[model samples]
Target: MHAISVRRVRRSLPRAALALVLAALGAALGPGAAPAAAAGHAEECSTEAGPYQKTVERHLKLTVDGVQSAADCAAIRTLQTRHGMEPATGRAGPETWRIVQYERAVADPSALTGCPHGTRLIVCVDLHRQLLWVWDGDHVATGPVPIRTGKSGYATRTGEHRIYERVEKQWSELYEGPMPFSQFFDGGQALHASYRNIWEEPGSHGCVNLRYDDAKRLWQGLRLNDPVYVWGTRGP
Candidate 1:
């Protein structure tokens, strides 16, 4: 009877261990796991607060008043993500805001016009709109970039000209300043990257001042002897 009792006790011990292992696994992966995963998903879907949030919110409100849907915001976020802007977790940070503003400015009707017919490669500048665009035949290759032309006494010349030279890093002898990625199409004036803010009201001194990145892209796209058309008059 004693031997029988010992065997029964050993069998019961194995069952107890199995039950303990199951309970430990249940505690680890039971109710808490779902909530944690749900929280992570929520974070993935939501935008984080940041410096440019207010600006983004204001723009959205103005564009679509009384709308609770986040469609517009999401669209902007999607664009930001595609561009690899930071905090692409559906948030409009500084990088995203800057890009959005640039795009809006570029899309202005005054900035866009048909490239001259029969032109294979052309750089089109609209002084009235303060914009520059690169055209490959009929299709736009680059730009609608914001630019700063000459201000006040110094006025940018308007006409059809050809790119005479390209200097990757040029120092302006006249202005005593750096001009990166300069494509000179006319005498004493070129399309070059500027240190000054291109968006500012008062612009450069006769040279077409482009943002650095835009200048680089323009430099890459334009070849020597490419035609450049500058139109629109300086304000009186």
Candidate 2:
């Protein structure tokens, strides 16, 4: 395993202020409590037909007309924006459709399909689908959230592993960046929050990158020694 260094766009907050914010968050919430989502303005809805326009329309229970109408765009855009998809375009794109699939699957336990479920917490990473979900035996403690895994040749390793370390805030000396809510399960590769948009192309070095809120919640929901199961090749 190699040291995983993530390239990200730094936020505006100063380092000290960011630290204080995180400290305040820890004090305000008990362990395993979910964090409230950060406030944001809704993205503009897309009017152009997405590549998978029909797929999105059918799933959103709209007329399967393959055309991107105002209503279709609004529904699709809302779903995309809520899931933190980049662009938040109402047009049905590959990433948008993938998120739709995950959302549908998350509602149905059987849709989880793989990654053994038992009494212990098991983190399941579906590289092909670009999603991660935490399974507490039969219960899903957290996740089924969107994620960006290693890109190109630096694919995230697949197999059974266990989290060995966790750091609420970890600094990467090699890359000179922050890896927040880092749960190191394999060598330097961990499940952590990426400062960059997880939907952006060309993914991480080898870590499983989640949204900030998702990673923070994962930190609270998971503990050391929790099993992690990763499988499937990332789709093109």
Candidate 3:
């Protein structure tokens, strides 16, 4: 789910070949990836098409998921990670292609990677907001998605922390893989994505589980060793 899209794709043979493949794939996703399907269930009818408050579904699909390109996707695996998504076989499932289609409607491959190197964009994952806000100077880009922080014995840490390293794709979580991205902090305390939301609510192993799209976008937008400040709504 790197921001580098086919649009930004160069005329290189590798990119061209991928585009040809993707055209077939994108076409297969047409009924779903088409503009009309922008919001999953009737976009124009949605009042909250309220700008970004709108979404069709989630995750992208690639017909040749594990083809091993020299591209960034070289990091991804073939199997569909548990609750996360795999590149759909082009059938356009509601969970994967369906969600990404809408992203296409609003996405600009060039615009997403605007954060310059060394510029610190403040990102605050407000548990209370149920929305993650990326603050670029005073500009805020927000998105709404499900997240699970912690349950009982494991509570999400509060206070300021700097992201030292980031993992684009992980393999340890076992089920859906260890999440595609982990802005690692102490040990396992990372801002990641998870499946067991315990009814789509806040529930995690002390890790902040952001929605997949949120994680993907944040992963691309954020640079190595970025700053993430997490504050809890619930007081100690």
Writing each residue's lDDT as its tens digit, candidate 2 over 25-62 gives 75678665524432243456777898889887888899
Clashing pairs in 2: 118-137
lDDT of 1 by residue, 1-236 (tens): 00000000011233335556656665778765432223112225343454566556565453533232366457656766555443355555544555555566565634367347345878988776566887786667787776767877767888899988888978765556778898888876788887554443455678888878999999888889989899886431
Sorted by lDDT (best first), the order is 2, 1, 3
Off by over 4 Å in 1: 1-111
> On residues 151-191, what C-alpha lDDT tens digit does candidate 3 reach at each position?
56666676666776677765443222456577765456676
Clashing pairs in 1: none
Ranking 1 against 3 by lDDT, winner: 1
Error of 2 at 124 (Å): 0.7
Misplaced by over 4 Å in model 2 are 10-48
All-Cα superposition RMSD per candidate: 22.7, 10.2, 16.7
Output the better candidate (1/2) by TM-score: 2
Quantify all predictions' global Cα lDDT against the true fold. 0.64, 0.80, 0.45
| Angstrom error at residue 167, model 3 | 1.2
